[model samples]
Target: MDDIMRAIFACIPGMRSPASPGGCLSAAFGGGDDDGEEGEGEGEDRISRLPDAVLSSIVSRLPVKDGARTAVLSPRWRRVWASTPLVLDDADLLPDDDGPQIFWRDVADAVSRVLAAHPGPFRCVRLTNACSYAGSRGAAALSRWLGVLAAKGVQELVLVFLHAWPVRVEPPADVLRVSSLRRLYLGLWRSFPDTEHLRPGADVFPNLVELGICRTDIKAKDLDRLLQCSPALETLAFVVSYNTQPNVRVRSRSLRCVLFWMSIAEELAVVVAPRLERLILWNGCPCTRRVRRDFRTRVKIGYTPELKVLGYLEPRIHVLEIANTVIEAGTKPSPGTMVPTVKVLAMKVRFGVRQEAKMLLSFLRCFPNVETLHIMSAEADEPTGKLNFKLKFWQDVAPVECLKAHIKKVVFKNFRGERSELAFLRFVLERAQILQTLVVVLTDGDGDHASQEELGNRLKPLIYSTHRASKCAEFFIFVRCGGTSWSFRTASDLSRSDPFDC
Candidate 1:
């Protein structure tokens, strides 16, 4: 158990020191015998020696089970959990055979006890448990706990109880109305008939800056009302849960950094924030066999002039990350619409046929100023076809004349020695007027491994082939992924210009 724990602890990113002995034993091995006085002393020794602030930080990130066990470590540790702020992360919460009523009852009881034991104002409170409990009793218990924390003047409150209780229980509006609440992350817990009943504009979170919600089923009117209430909100992130047929138009005046992640089913209608500097959207079809069934399907998308204001980086925005999506052929934006000012574009195209090449070429037309481009194969049953997609993609997208002027270098990692692949290198060599350097990264997956002798013999003819060969500054084919251990035979001297027998 200790060895297993040490292995796991070694994998902890950026953690230089060893894991706390108490935490390791408690989590990996069963809770060590604490029935006697000697056990109590051992627990106390682990708690008292460790830094309190470190312990607090560690406990906050851990699951409730692990965090609760720390309290049994020693007398000092017993009350530390209540004193330290709690960030209830429900990402790891999985359903069990135990009914919802019993589950939430236990959770609510534990939370209530902790809060009551330490009545001090907490730094933050995040409750994101989405379990279908039996009755409205569990919801009531949650509200009561939240009410207590609200009364205590908590700084950051994040209530995310999506699909937990069936009743349309309203959130503790009295707590949300508090001016002290700076960061609020409230997601949908229960269904609401109207925005007014939930008291949207009636309350104000004056100091609120950052708010995030996922799977929230707020209507257009309700969304507007909620936005109006938070006049000072700066960073707003929404991961749409439900697919509204017509799609809702989102407008935020004070929002600067907006992150919208929704399915392609919804219209991408969002009024461009004038003061917005960064807008990120994750909208693309899933990378699976399902896409093949949905191909050539024209989905309705909405846009407005407000989005066009930032002619450089709004509307569709920049820094795109689309995976396993086949963009319909013949779909082009308006004529005057110059591509947004894109700096870096990372795309994982799923389509295999010539259409994929055409789409790559099409997408590149929009990002004329793109400096770096990264493309990878998607996780599908079929392989990225035997064609020279990358070469074709680059040839069609990167105009020879323009590339020579702007593009500084070209790098092909998985370079197979196909005629098309060779033609790609030849094209770049012939076209790129200002091309300074060309890097070819080879892979052994292509075919049988050729020895260094065979490669040198093949290139021996190139020395006296033509003057174009001399212009090549660095024309060495990297072998076996090319690292420190890579052995390069000095086949012909670097200065040797003759192609004949050396």
Candidate 2:
């Protein structure tokens, strides 16, 4: 405090050196008078008087309590925050020693005050409450707050509640009754409400565009009803867990993106999304032995027609994530499985003794139009154990002829330029007729500098050699070791033709 005061005093002339920082002496002597004069009439009234609209904008950006605190700055700001437009974050509620009831009472009081203070409809309202007690007191309290906001016609509303205990609670029906609600994210953890308890002939959310839910138990029929209510919904995210069997089908015609990480009890009965562009399925549950055990009933993965991004559908999907997990079983799948016409396909397999070259080869045969293919191996203490089989799989799968004309680019990360890598390259060089460029990067593992250089040297010969290279072979090799050295673009004939001519 003394330092600041002294700095301000030093801004005046003849108080300190002429080259004082921020002209401390000049500021101290003239700053306050200039500011006072500006506040009254002449000089700069624009700079002096804070506009009500600007104050409201500033308050609107800040949370409830912070905006209210700004009132103490000056007399002009006394009623500014009151009508700034409420945007509350319910996570601001923490356990107080005053007991849960009092705590909730205070919270309700604050919300009521803020709502009363702000005249117009709130732009954003977020009410999230967690429960420690078995009874849903917090949820009940939150319902009242949401009801108030709904009445005010808030535009954006988010409600997330994670309960430590399972409690039966009914949602405030009035929240859905809000006509002005456009975007909503509602998530309930621990348990969910009874689906049969829904209000009859209710269709409330007509203006909602984006609906996101997490850790919620929504039955199929109930979900379908909910989707039906939100006819204008464009994007939907359902982070489902546990054995949630949603029997009711959900169809979103306006939806462009759909993310589902849940377990559907029955096989995908209604996997139809006509306008869906991106479909992300992160199946947390592994395929049951009941399903995989029946060799006759080969699990057929079904997806929407127009899906551009589809991944992480099943566990032990070794063909999907070759970089992390390894392939365990090597079963030759029957041919004639119709492959969906998708632009991008990413696959990885869990590593095991039996290599899945045949299975992968069969799978790759499905993707005739795949433009890019990426393959990686798992990192393990015993690299030789599972790696050898994986290497063999790569060797068998890498017959350039298999990827000819279709695949134009291939990227191999954690590449060491080993025999497996060389064999893969040989396959590319032989098969990919329209292959424009091939990139092999060496990433340092175990801080081995010698190994990094060895990998780099091994890649250089493969790229520069003119023995038997692909017609469109343009190689690029990058050796990245500890972020110090990077050698990208090992071989390229820039003078001959433009690399990116297409």
Candidate 3:
């Protein structure tokens, strides 16, 4: 306290240092009439004079400790802190260099105290400390804090347990009881409560609008129940849970976006989602330490008429089904096979492989209304039959209707400038009559400076052929090192419209 006061005093030349930190803060924010002229008549503790509502708003935005510390400023501010809706984040309570080492137990205790102190109506709270409630005592601690939150009516809550994997300690079913929650994210939990057999009018997550479950052990039935309970849920995300293999059936009328990332799941069936717009699937690859689970996740699209954004659909990995028909490489594109509602589409294709190229064609044919297209050029390991399936394939295939009419933008990722890749670029440049922008994200060639110049010259020839498909098209080139680390916020953000626009 003395040191903090001394530091504040050191900043001012003639001002005497306060003996206590509280006095220093009082002088800073709770200044009297004498201090008003010190800073050119602008030092009249204007913050302290603010209306209680305005002051409470300011305090609510601060970290838990910082907001609570404002109490020492004045009785008015103290009252403000007490009255304002609590916004706590456990990450903000970490130990400083001068402070004593803070263990998880200490943080948990502090969080409990903070939750208890603030009377009611928690606006947003994120608890991400690696707190291992070891035994019965820890279990009791968890229940006590969760009980506080449930009683207080927390609106938005994100609880990420950073404990050791595989030992997912189940938090009490009090989680489902927080009917006040409008948004909830639970990471590394065992399971969500099964409220399937609840009484006639029993409320289960009645107010939850956005629910995110990550690395949790969830069953298909429980997932269904969660959906059934959360009638207002507009967005649902299941991310990277190797322990659970859920054949997710989307049966919610309110769900607009579903993000499935790095999860070892069997299938995702949009059976009854009328409002669903985006179905984003990232990696099916295995996690770093775990034994590789089979990556195929059959995607079935049924009753989703409002669906607009689709994919990162790997040609080899995902088995696409539309209107109860499984989309195959040889399946002819017809009215029954198409999803006419999809506008923005993304696909992972190995243009070098003949089968995948054909599959890519089939997938494109299925989405006839696609306006903006993103093609991720996947690297081929072993040839899936004939190699370097060139421009002839693109020229000979049944005309891709979207290319000639609907497509306004196309982003080709990992553009290695191979014969097949260049041929496709030539194909698009020649065919997409309405194309507005073309982006080529290269795979960062190993060529030297001179070789790079030669490659550039080659690309220019493709960019400027005797073709006049789109007269006003702009072009750009970028290098893709690996990629950005995926997150729920980035993937499920409907605002991004095009994930590959970057």
Per-candidate Cα RMSD to the true structure, in Å, reads 12.3, 12.7, 8.5
Q: Which candidate has the highest lDDT of all?
A: 3
lDDT of 2: 0.49
CA lDDT of each prediction against the hidden true structure: 0.45, 0.49, 0.71
Q: Give me the overall lDDT of model 1.
A: 0.45
The TM-score values for the models, in the order shown, are: 0.56, 0.64, 0.84
Identify the runs in model 3 with alpha carbons over 4 angstroms from their true place: 1-46, 49-54, 98-101, 134-138, 196-202, 284-294, 444-455, 471-487
lDDT of 3 at 281: 81
lDDT against true structure, model 3? 0.71
Q: For residues 1-502, could you state the per-residue lDDT of candidate 2 as single tens digits?
A: 2332232112111211123222211111122242233433334434225577975776665545666666654455556766666666544433424464545455556665666666657777665443222126645655556666777878887655534335644455445667678777655544344445444435557788766655556667766667666767766765543345523244756665655543333433324466655544444333233344322211233444665544333323323312122222342222234334544444432223234334445556555666766544333333343454323555455443337656766655566565545655665665676666565556557768788888788877666662433465364434444332211110011121211111
Indicate the TM-score of model 2.
0.64
Ranking by lDDT: 3, 2, 1
Q: Where is model 2 more than 4 Å wrong at Cα?
A: 1-57, 71-85, 93-105, 130-135, 138-140, 165-175, 190-203, 246-250, 261-270, 283-303, 313-336, 351-358, 373-402, 409-430, 435-502
Q: Using alpha carbons, what is the TM-score of model 1?
A: 0.56
List, residue by residue over 1-502, the lDDT tens digit for candidate 1.
2332232122112211234533443322134444212342233434344576866777765555566667876655666666666554333233335565446545555566656755566666655443223124444665566667667777776665444345534454444555667676555544322456545555466777766554445567766776767767766655443433335455666665554543233343445445444444444312222334432312211222222111111122122222222233333433233234433333434434444544544554544454433332222335455666444544454452224444344444344443434444465455555455455544335344564334334433322342232244655432234222211111111222211111
**Backbone-clash count (model 3):** 0
